[model samples]
Target: MTSIGIYGSLGRMGQAIIEVAPSLGARVAGGADAQDDPAPIAAKADVLVDFSAASALDAHLAAARAAGTPIVIGTTGLSAKQHEAIDAAAQEIAVLQTGNTSVGVNLLARLVRDAAARLGGDWDVEIVEMHHHHKADAPSGTALMLGEAAASGMGTTLGEARVTDRAGLVGARAEGTIGMASLRGGSVVGDHTVIFAGQGERIELTHRADDRAIFARGAVRAALWLAGQKPGRYTMDSVLGDAVLGA
Candidate 1:
């Protein structure tokens, strides 16, 4: 069984992981919170799952690197600099980082990408996501991930194709661009929908997350898969495997 360590042990996701780990044939090596030192936990576990704040990402990555342990990061709201840090850490220790750990969400991303590729630039892409009111970020990380998938299919980058804010008098929707809208409300676990609009018709792909346990289940599965891998950066798609992608 994999020995799993958790960062942000007190958070909802962390608690969910702890609850589900044993059933998945894993043991909790330990955990660390904001006031706790993660190095010790990192050193002792076969793999580490991070659901902590973005500000603490550097320290957690450092700890994982120092201990030569694989890490699965499910933290959201990461800045470009933090992503750079993750990339750097990946050079040494195996790193699997994703905006959302739900297997359904990753599979949704793949489908979005495939649809974008097949539909071509003639289709306008827009992603709308809703999360719980307590969620702090706008255009939730998973929204951006879906946008990136559509952009990748269209052979453009999200930075170039993404249009997040559109208010009154924004003119017509730009061609070949991906739009993102975020909503916050009461106790919504998560909801994402990708819309593709063309001249005569429209296609929509959606995924709804009803509970946090799904994320925890996926994260543990990712940690188990990552534990045996060599040092490198990975994504949830890799965890789902190429067979699923082909399917």
Candidate 2:
């Protein structure tokens, strides 16, 4: 059986991964928390999964690199510098980092990309997301991921096309810019909806995650798939075949 290491052992997503690994034909070799050194677990396991805080990402990435073990990072709220670090690390060991790991969310990104590409620039793209009150990040990682998809569909980067805030005197929505809004409240697992507004008509696509298990299960599946792959940056689209996605 494949042995997977957990980087945020005490957190909900980590616990969920451990809870569901058995049914997926994998074993949790061990895990580490914020207060512990992750290298020990990294050295022992065949692959590692990180649902840890963004603050702990560098150390975790360093540990995995030293061990030459493939790692899947599910951490969110990362800075641009941290993203640069992931890009640098990908050259040495296989790295798969995603805002959200749920299959539904990833597939939603695909659909959003397709819709945005075909709908033309007249369609105003807006993404909205919500999560539990405990979530540290606004515009959950999943929200940014969707934004990236929409931007890509329109042949642009999110930085150039995103509108994250609006205040007094804000005029009409700019053409070709994608807007984002985030909500936080009681125990919501996750909810994301992408709106495509056009003249006299609108289309909205959405996905709701009711349990943490969906993310954990997808993470495990990604870990298993990354085990034997060559060093490079990978995505959920790599794990979920495009043929299946196209169907």
Candidate 3:
């Protein structure tokens, strides 16, 4: 059985991962969060999974390094500098980072890419997402990622084509623009959809995250898959098979 470290052990997702430990063949060696140093607990762990705040990453990385533990980071909202830090640390240790952990979400992103690659630019692409009111980010990292997936497939960059949520009487939807919209309310975990609109018909692909456990399960699966990987930056796409994603 793999001994796991749950950074942000007190948070909703962390506790949820711990709750499903048995079925995944894992044991919580220890954990840490903003309120406490998971070091005391994480010391015994073999793989450290950081799901804590982006702010706490420095401490988490230091501790994981000292423990000689490979790390899997699930925290989103990281700046370019923060990503630099994570990438720098990966030179000395293994690190897996993802904007979202749901296998479905990653697969959805790949599907969006495939569709964009097959369809002409005339088929406008748009993304919509809904999450709990507590979420801080406007677009939700997953939404932006999906947009990036489509943009990448079309041989362009997202920054150039993105049409974020609109206000006022925003003119008409521009051709070739990848639009993004967001919704917040109640205790929603997450929901995402991508629409490909063409002159003749439209296609929609959606993923509804009814519970946070789905994410936790994906994280655990990623951790296990990373256990034997060569030290480097990794994503959920690498953990899951190509048969499911086709990319």
For every model shown, what is its TM-score relative to the native structure?
A: 0.97, 0.97, 0.92
Any runs in candidate 3 off by more than 4 Å, and if so which?
243-247
Q: In terms of TM-score, which candidate is stronger, 1 or 3? A: 1
**Candidate 3, 11-97: lDDT as tens digits:** 998999999877999888767777787566557887888888888888887876676678899987777888888788787778899
Top of the candidates by TM-score: 2
The regions of model 1 sitting more than 4 angstroms off are 243-247
Q: If both were scored by TM-score, which would come out higher, candidate 1 or candidate 2?
A: 2
lDDT of 2 by residue, 162-215 (tens): 998897889988888999999999999999999999999999999999999999
Query: Candidate 1's residue-wise lDDT over 1-247, tens digit each?
Result: 8899999989999999999999999999989999898899999999999998998999999999999999999999999999999999999999999999998899999899999999998899999999999998888989999999999999999999999888889998889899999999999999999999999999999999998999999999999999999999999988888765443
Where is model 2 more than 4 Å wrong at Cα?
Answer: 243-247
TM-score result, candidate 3: 0.92
lDDT per model, in order? 0.94, 0.94, 0.85
Sliding window of 10 residues with minimal summed lDDT for model 1: 238-247
Better of 1 and 3 by lDDT: 1
Question: What TM value does model 1 have?
Answer: 0.97
When sorted by TM-score, best at the front, the candidate numbers are: 2, 1, 3
